[model samples]
Target: MNQAPLPSYAPLAEVVRSGMREGVHYGAVVGLSAEGEVAYARGPVHDAMFPRSSAKPFQALAALRAGAPLEGTSLAIAAGSHGGEDFHAAETERILAAAGLTAEALRCPPAVPGGAAARKAFLAAGRSPERRYMNCSGKHAGMLAACVAQGWSTDDYLDPEHPLQVLVREATEDMCGERIAHTAVDGCGAPQLAVSLVGLARGIQGMRLSPEGSSERTIIEAMSAHPEYVSGTDRIDTELMTRMPGLVSKIGADGVLVLNVPTGETVAVKISDGDAEERARVLVGLTALRGLGVDVAPVKEHLTTPIQGGGRTVGEVRGL
Candidate 1:
């Protein structure tokens, strides 16, 4: 592994408080070199916090590695999360059909997508909420399909010890360059693994380094190709990937963001206090990316700043 310079950051108190001031932050940011070594890291608090959707790529890789058949949109949907748009939902349905599965097989929680129009449509349909509408339904569907392909039990596919989860666990550990020290249930009710910020970055780097036939590489390529499907329009994760060349990013609930830069840089950021206010974790992560000379202005513009009506800047992120 190549050792890179580590930069020190001010306390979260300083980084958290912008010129506007007010709000708290709790999280860590870690950068990894192309060689999968920690370049810089800091966290106000660290434990096995849930990575939420940020873990999707790794989990998808696990499914593929477990013998899942994947295609363009199917692979995209596997790593993706549709915004519950008609197209996204339709694609999800098609994927299920191709796999000889159904929405009944999904295990993700039911919720409207991030889009207001989509949410309205969901409500207007008067259809009961099901796992299919859940953003993670695609991932769940993929997992179940993988089980079918591998002849593994889907009874507890989400269990950490299940064959699929076990493959994911090994892949996760291999990418992180460390063992998983903690685990928690994700928002989607799947097992979530927590690694050091550095470990998370290495895991991302590992995916990039994996061979084309490898599942990790497939997920990375899918996500990179379909950044929009990975996240919705105006979503920070989607915008970041779309605007930045060779970058694939995923943001988890509770202020967690992870990115793999084409230059072989991998980064993860988490906020300790989980303040939804400043989006402090993302600010710190973007700043760190910029500090490391990543061209993230497009991402910073879309994600780090919230615009009021008439495009007025109501609030902007401040961090280093």
Candidate 2:
């Protein structure tokens, strides 16, 4: 009853250059009303798509359900794609330590810090790429903590067939309110389940609107309360949650974004252009928010990316 049937791909944004259009970013977007019905939708809202990191909130809920004991910054980071700042790294280490584990237990591929400044400082300090610096390390660490809590094997935690991953699958399916159409390995090696944009919007809104003391409410509150840990300092998720009270927002890799307003309005968007940049995504998502009655002007100024021509700012990408 939440989803509205919608059509094929729609043009969500445009690359503008000197008053001329450069190209279009085609994608799907879905919005849910405060009452839980699909308010509006464009593109293929019914088709399966990967939510990527936007799925972290549910993953964190599964961790909690499995007895990870997450709260505050710990819960936020467990559901965040944190920029690898020093504070982010330190917290990740703390999570692993709580379970009597070390960074050596992380199976994610090693990577330098995700932030430009942090990566530069880390390399300057003679630190090599490390698994903890990977943005997904926090999620992996929380999973490990849950595994340890439940006596699940730690070595194959990333395996889809693992008991922890089974919890992940169940949590994801329960939130999205649909069976996963496909299961695939994500960039960080966790299982990625496919759901429609409508389902994503519905799920996020449902979680945000869930009653107090629920796992869903816990995830939303922790994320909103500790936005900096959910992402990192100055990041989009952090900035949005900081600037706007009572909004739960997260950006996913591969042009995915989900936003839930305190009023229960939620929007889920996927930028379909392989060439589309991250900046383009928030702009499109903000447009969806504006349509749902949120005043987006407070955050729209620098959220959209500007185009460069002859070393000067020439254009921008705006949602259609």
Candidate 3:
């Protein structure tokens, strides 16, 4: 294995202390094409980073390629880090049922809902967290479906040595148009592939620009068409796709965000400290898109987060 140097990140955004006029945080951004074209960039585009859940789209695409019978909301949820709302859980169940499986088959750990209201409702109902309520349940369900479809074993599907995992790794590398430099277990226990920020951008750009009828296109269309299934209400990924036409976005753990617009533009942002304070990833992402001559003004305000202090709006965190 070839070892790569740590990413040399440049400032992509700044968080200022309200009314104090001082920066508190810094991050990096990268914009590129599958063809290795650098459309716009900041920080280190060549260094490897864990894409986390942002890789869900590609993982879903791989499942589709593996003959998973996913469509509509099921397909969208497969590519989502959903809020585990009722609808989200139902959709996940639907996918598992389609595969002749059950929630017990999911390898990811059980967790409360990602949406605050849903979590509260769950606890109020005297219910405990279950695998179905895991935010990654949808993704795991889809993986199970793919296994069933391909006659692969449901047991140990999350293992890196599984055939399904091999397909996922291949699909990820293929889409990124680069080799995986490192691999680790993701939060949900799936294999996490590390690639350059430029590579991440390239992967999304490929999905956005893929020809009609391609699995890549299918994943992109499903996600864009059902943004609500992707992340639930009020989430940045859901809101961005819903409010912006011809746009697909996904948020990963540890402050990673990826966006692709219809015009073949792609952007990826990574906060050095993995702090998603005030939705900084989305703010910086929109800012990067704006720099690429994309008109994000319509949703700019929605993405710009208000910085508060003393229980009042003190300032704002705008893209740098």
Best by lDDT: 2
For candidate 2, the lDDT comes to 0.87
> Pairs clashing in candidate 3?
none
lDDT of model 3 at position 126: 91
Error of 1 at 200 (Å): 1.0
RMSD of each: 5.3, 3.6, 2.0
Q: How much lDDT does each candidate structure score?
A: 0.71, 0.87, 0.85
lDDT of 3 by residue, 1-320 (tens): 87656567776555566556556446578876434479788887778889999899889988898999998889999999888799999999999988888898999998888887888899899988798888889999999999999999998999888999999999999999889988899988899999877888888888878898888888889999999899988577888898897799998989899988888878998887786554578888888888777889779694567877899888876666
Cα lDDT of model 1 overall? 0.71
1 or 3, greater by lDDT: 3
Question: Clash number for model 2?
Answer: 0
Q: Give the TM-score of candidate 1.
A: 0.86
Q: Which of the two, 2 or 3, has more lDDT?
A: 2
lDDT of 2 by residue, 1-320 (tens): 57644336789888899999998888888888899888778888879988999999888988999999788898899999998998888898999999999999999889998766787889999988889989999999999999999999999999999999999889888988998888999999999988888888888888888899988988999899998888877578889888887888899988899999888999998887633357677877888888888887778774467889999999987777
TM-score of 2: 0.95
Q: Write one digit per residue (lDDT tens) for candidate 1, span 1-320.
A: 87433323235433322255554344578777666566666763234455667777778888887778876677777777667776676767777777787777777777776566777777888866666767887788788888989888776888888888888788788776677877788878788887766666667778888877677777888888887677666566676777886788887777677888877777788775565653566667777676566777766563354424455655454553
